[model samples]
Target chain A: MVKRLSVLDANRCTGCQSCMFACSRRFGVGGLAYSAIHVRSVGGIEHGFVVIVCRACPDPPCAKVCPVDALKVRVGGGVILDAAKCIGCGFCAKSCPYGAIFWNERENKPNICVYCGYCAGYCPHEVIALEELG
Target chain B: MDEYLKNILYIDLSRKRFWVEDRGSLFEEYLGGVGVASKILLEECPKNADPLGPENVIVFAVGPLNGLFPLASKTVACFKSPLTKSYGESHAGGRSAIAIRQAGYGAIVIKGASETPVYVAVHGKNIIFRNASALWGLRNSITVGRVLREIEGGAGVRTIMRIGVAGENLVSYASVNTETYRHFGRLGLGAVFGSKKLKAVIVSGKTMISVSNVKRYRELYDKIYTTSIKSSVMKKYHDLGTASNIIPLNTIHALPTKNLRESSFEYAENISGERLAEKYLGRRVACAHCPIACIHLAALREPYVTEPYFYKTTMISYDHELLYALGSMIGVKDTEGVLKLIDEVEKWGVDAMMTGTVLAWMTEAYERGIVGENEILGLKLEWGSVESYTKAIEYIVKGVNEFYKTASKGLDALTSRYGGEEFSLSYGGNGMPGYHTGPGAHLTYLTGARHSHLDSAGYSLDQETLKGKQLSEKEIAEKLYHEESWRQILSSLVVCFFSRGIYTPETVCETLDILGYSFNEVELKRLGEKILSNKNDFKEREGFNMLNQRFPKRIFETPTPFGLLEEKTLYESVKEFYKILKERARNS
Candidate 1:
């Protein structure tokens, strides 16, 4: 069994961007440039938000689309980015179906969610969660 | 070099030329946002520059804490006001501050008028001026935002600010709608934009800011985050947004209803926060870097008159000020009516507060036979009539006749011609905010630098007085001056005022310390005072005389929750305020 971050109910999201901040803080930096998780309004915020985070697929599309084999599939799920081998080309970000892959434009690297569930901790509305998957 | 405050973008709309200058010294002294912007306005703008002329400058400034901390979400816009014809400052909480900071600029100074309409796009260091001939005269601001969103990339970390027909026509109280829900909603920033022939500004970037002490930063971040989420002080804002104040203010009879003829509205319950949340609350939203989602949007569904099955759902943001101004002040009792009025104001890109106050005055004038039906364009002007008010808004933006043209200038100009000076309710040429709390509210409006309620928040003082606290006029003046001075520090941090409790002087110093800028409590307070003095100096230089303001007789006529505001007490408070300002000037 492995714990995975999940969007329980995205309609409860207030578009607070707390999860995005938490994701950025994991890198000891501020701003949304390097956040693994992303939240955006559906056209306008009145329609609610679309919370995009890696769903921890067994065979991640982001890992499959990597040009230089920089992204390696984890044991449980999700993918780990090997920054050394990466070409800084944004193919993985484009290939991710859920739009979960975040690009660090400053470094030209893909910031992937490693199923750490750090972002879920900051969601006050219980819009996201970390649960065991068997 | 300060990492975030590195570049100041200077855009000359007339020449279509743009350059980035290193403004490290400006940010180092003023620390950004209003502090930096006020200095820029003073330096660039001519002494008596026409607010709607090429001589006027528009400054968009973000602070040091902007991309580095939570709730540091406001971008301050400083300019010569077309409304006040003096020092103008307004703030909007959206992605604007973060986008500007990330876009690698401390401040953006826009000067000179463009020969034709245009929108500037700043994607990191790239500044592109696109012709906005088509965007000009757009009926709805939301459409302008939508069109820009498609044209401009940077989906997540970008802010699109646009104005509508009200701004295009140079309505004196027009606003610049940021993102959709948030706005620089006072003193006619949109009219300033219009004067420049600028329709929109799109800012987006991906820049990482470095923190000096990562460990300590995380600890303080966690502490602030925990406090913001768990603290009861922020709970009310999170739940019902600022509209939570409606019930409490109404209960205390402080809510100005129907042009301040009454202290409270009879149907306050209909438009109450509790009712709105229960019935119409579509969703809550937050500005970038803010954990508290205080922006409340109501879902308004309207069926097409021609098509039986066709319907349109619109999202309208509401708050305490909007509730008071558009809801109670204009005598709108229905929640739907209030939402509709707010939506119209949003679509037109006009300041809701000023629009409501102007309409309230007009309604009163019509009832008194001061302005006849002919002047009202054959439409009956009555309180609680949302349809009539809506039509008036249309006429105002259209500016077709003499009455509409005069009305577009604001209540000051309208009353100056129409013989309703007694109940004009404009302080320093800007229409009044919702609060008719007491002498404190009135005095702040008269003496505060920007003539904004947020300048001093005298309503809080009035509430404290209602709790059996007695204070002299001098004490009230001192408290106001101190609070407003402290707010300079807050606004420099570019933090939202709602989170003032979280960002105390000590906490502010700590946050700054993390960013490698050291300032103790004493140093911070001194800096606050300095900033206040600079703002007041700018205001004074612009011909704002504290003694010269005409007190509206209507405020004294109406009895507030505390009681009728005394003219002598208000005058004493103003005198005290001036004395403090003079003393501070001498000391500095």
Candidate 2:
């Protein structure tokens, strides 16, 4: 079974950024600095929100663009960054169509979702969920 | 203190310069948010400075707990009010608090006026002042937000507080709109921004915080998160939002109707929270870091005149205050009319409560012949005429005539020129918020530091009075003073009022203690008292005399759950509260 976080319904998102905090909390203290998932308003908040996260594409463009073999394919469809082999070129971040590649400006490294589903637990509105796809 | 909270960002619009100062000592004693802001307002603003002048200061602050705890999500803005011409403070919940905290500052003190229209962007240590002359007289505040959203770098984390046409024209009660659904909604912050030629302040940052004790923090976090979702108070706030209060307040004959001429509306049920939820409730939203998504937006759909299929749906945020002011107070019976009026004010970026109050006073004055068709500038204002009221809202921004211009100044200014002082329902110079419970609400309106219902729960005290335990004036005064003093702690923590019940005195102490701030419940209470007295010091310094407050005659005419209030009782209580405050200032 492969498990990953997904936005069950964008309409249910209140744009509270709770999931962002939760995602960040996994790396350190509760904060938005380390978040991989994001919920931005569609033009304005009155229109609602757009939840952006890595959808775990099987043929990922982010991996294809990487000059060095820094991003290794996971058991499922997502890729995990090997920080030791990686250079801070930012090509992976620029190549993602969903804009899911989050950058750590302080370290100049890309922070991609680990598919841990930690953020799903903190979404108060049940707008997100961890799904098991077999 | 958290090391990040020690930095205070000082921005000078006149020189287009910025600096950072570490005010660690201030955080040690006064804490952050309102406590620090009140003192800063005193220092930066000149004595009795013009509220809309360049000398007036804007202090936006968050507490030590902000960006660290749940529901610690509000940014406190303190300034000299053009509306009240006294100590002014307003709070808003959005990404503002989080952004400011992550930007590595406890407070941002803005002084001096920009000669040209501009919007300030603060990205952590980065600061940019961009020219915004093109955005200056935009018809809708929503459009301004849309424009900023496209150009701004921080998509999810940033908060853009922009004013609209009403603000650009210096409507005294104009609001600072945030996140479309939220606002710093009272006491003329927008007018101050307009006077400075400041269009918007966009703030965003991404910084990691370190925790002292991981397990304890996690345990406490889970407790607060669970309590916020499970508590009945939070449930009500979540389920229907605050509009649920309409039915209950109307049942108790406490809902202000038609400018308080009637305590309850005959068509109360027609526009109640239940009615809106059933018909037009579109979606729910929340401020940053808050679990209780209490903000309810209504989707109103209207067809084009020529084509039935060509329709547009507009999303408008609604709460009890907006409903009371635009619905019952202005005599709009249907939900559609109320939503339309609410939407109209939202577009203009004026304080919805003040705008609604102004419209109500205008309608009453017109009916009484105090102001004729000539004074109102050719429009016939009726009780439920949404069309005419909509026209008046535009006139407030356009300044079509003398009467609409005066209306923009507020009820206090309106009643002075016209002869309807007795019917005007403002306290000090600020317009009255929803709630007509009795003496407690009236006392709160008159005595609260910012003259807001939220300064203390006088409405809660009305429950005691309703139960027939008649409180003495001293008892009433002491109870209110104590409650208000305690709330100073909450505001200093920068916690949302909805989470106050969850953050009890002990819990607050514990939370602070965990953050390396050692304090017992008693010490915390003492700190709360000191912070409150500091606010009063600013109010009194700016010529806000508690002794000079006048009760509107309309309050006595209307009956509430606590029955018709005795003016003498409220007067003595105000006096006793004055004595209590004086004694504290002396002791301090």
Candidate 2: clashing residue pairs, number: 0
TM-score of chain A as modeled in candidate 1? 0.94
Clashing pairs in 1: none
Model 1 per-residue lDDT tens digits across residues B1-588: 356685899999999999989888888888999899999999999999999999999999999988878888999999999998989999998889988998988999999999899999999989999999999988899999988888788776789988999998999999999989999999999999998899999999878777767799889988888899887878899899889888888888888898888888999998889999999888888898788888899988889999899999888999999999999998898999999999999999999999999999999999999999789988778888999999999999889899988999998999889989898879988888888787778888888888989998898888888787778999999999988988998999899998999999989988888887878988887788888888888888888888888789989888888688888888988999999978876775
What DockQ does candidate 1 score? Answer: 0.70
DockQ of each: 0.70, 0.74
Candidate 1 docking: what grade? medium
| Model 2 bad stretches (over 4 Å) | none
For residues A13-90, write the lDDT of model 2, one tens digit per residue.
Answer: 988888888887777575677789998888778788999988887778989999998988777688889988889899
Q: In model 1, what is the error at residue B573, expressed in angstroms? A: 0.8
In candidate 2, residue B38 scores what lDDT? 91
How high is the lDDT of residue B571 in model 2?
95
